[model samples]
Target: MSSTLLAPVLEREEYIEQAYFFRTLAERLREGVPAQMALLQIRDELLTTTRLPWAVEFLATELKHSGQLGSGMKRLIHYFTPFQAFVMTKAEEEGVRFSLDHALKVLEGEARYRSENPTPAGLFVYEFEVLARCQLGYQNGLDCMEQDSFFDEDWRQFIETVRRSMSEVEFADLIYLYSEQYIQDQQRAGREGPFPRPLFGLKEGRIAKASHGRDPLYLFAALQRQLGYPEVPRLRLPTEQRGVLQMLEHKVRELELRLRLLEGEVRGQVEVIQALGKPETAESSLEWLKRLDNEE
Candidate 1:
């Protein structure tokens, strides 16, 4: 656990700049730029007064050596949240499909949300979705999220419950049980135990209840639809890549076509070479080969 987890230390403006820094860094990274270079470039783009410039400058230096932005972020615990660092660290793990670009987008959206009036439920759902959708460790993700300063003791306790019961329980039911609607239902039934304060509103409870027995993703979608919470960005699912043999064959064919066109151009034979790309026949192939041999 981080020392700053008990209290938020950074200003709202800092988070705003962090969002910009991450968004710009991610964009530059997609352009095939190295992580250190991307951080250096984005560091210059940040406002002079914001701590982000200093932070990213440090990140650039750290990335220059370690090549891991998450490590840099973790070192700056006073500025960046643990969840932000967790996302990046998870993205950096080997054999994981999560990329630095996707991790940046996730942090960018969450920072923008935190800069505004973020609710406990909203942040929880957003962070949880980041873990669930990205296939990060659920227990570790929830542990990181639970330490956020925005959540109270009740929220922390509930997150622990989620950590314990996650493998055995439905996420929607978890929310529904802790919500206002559940408290109301208990009251209506004349149950008299001390109830914890509601972490979720009546609407959220109803939505979670309605989402019972369904895919848990729909619960997150419903919350995003109704509450305007930030949605986690997902890595693009990998499409079938071309096989090595297929690529080699395609390259060979391309080289042959280019060679034919070049030979035709040298001999001032434009029409015949231009038609070489069209459907090939044995006769046309022979004619093209003969023409190429003439140039030789």
Candidate 2:
């Protein structure tokens, strides 16, 4: 494993700026802005004192050259975490339905949480929930997470154990076993052998115990409710849903345009040939709509 996961080296301001960077990038992409142009524009908006602007500049340059932001992020190991790079790489992979925009939102949430002074348990649960909900591979995802500098040695070991035994174990049970509540219960039952060091506290233990045998998402939710852990952003709509939404939006736009054309013709201010000759982005009513028939 790369030693880049040792400990968070960036300042609080860096994380704050990173959160903004990711958020703005994701938003721009959603608004139909090109990635390289969005990166350049956002670079000017970041705090000049922070390193994020320089990093964004580098990402833009890399994207211009290699047509990939993940490649640049991977090369900037000193600035970006391995998990961040891993997420980007996964998002950029061919045949993966996960889009780069969705990955940016995920990073935005993580960076925002980090800027708020996150605890190891909270970060672990947040990152794990991201992987679980996003359908990112648990084995590789947990491996990258285990190396995060935010986690101590014990946390790393526990994550490694989870990565290996996740198939055989219920996630909630694992949390319950390594928690202080488990030790207390064992002592009360007159069982006195060596016990693993508690990584999760009493609150987590209780929540996990209550959540055992249920969906792991319930365990995550219970922890979030009781502990104020950072919430993982939900995944983007599935491909089929997105396609249906796009079709509906296209239909709505077409209807609006047709209504505008009818009104223009009734007023004797427009002709079919003139309207069709105008660019899709013409300042007329068509400006608000794409050529609905254009292929994506």
Poorest 10 consecutive residues by lDDT, candidate 1 = 235-244
Per-residue lDDT over 213-268 for candidate 1, one digit per residue giving the tens place of the 0 to 100 score = 99888888888888776787765532422455556766666567667768667878
* Candidate 2 structure, TM-score to reference: 0.79
TM-score of each: 0.79, 0.79
lDDT of 1 at 103: 88
Tens-digit lDDT track for model 2 on 116-186? 97888888998899888888899888877876777888888899999888889999999999999999999
- CA deviation > 4 Å runs, candidate 1: 1-9, 236-277, 280-296
Q: What's the C-alpha lDDT at position 163 in model 2?
A: 89
- True-structure Cα RMSD, model 2: 8.7
Q: Quick one: best lDDT, which candidate? A: 2
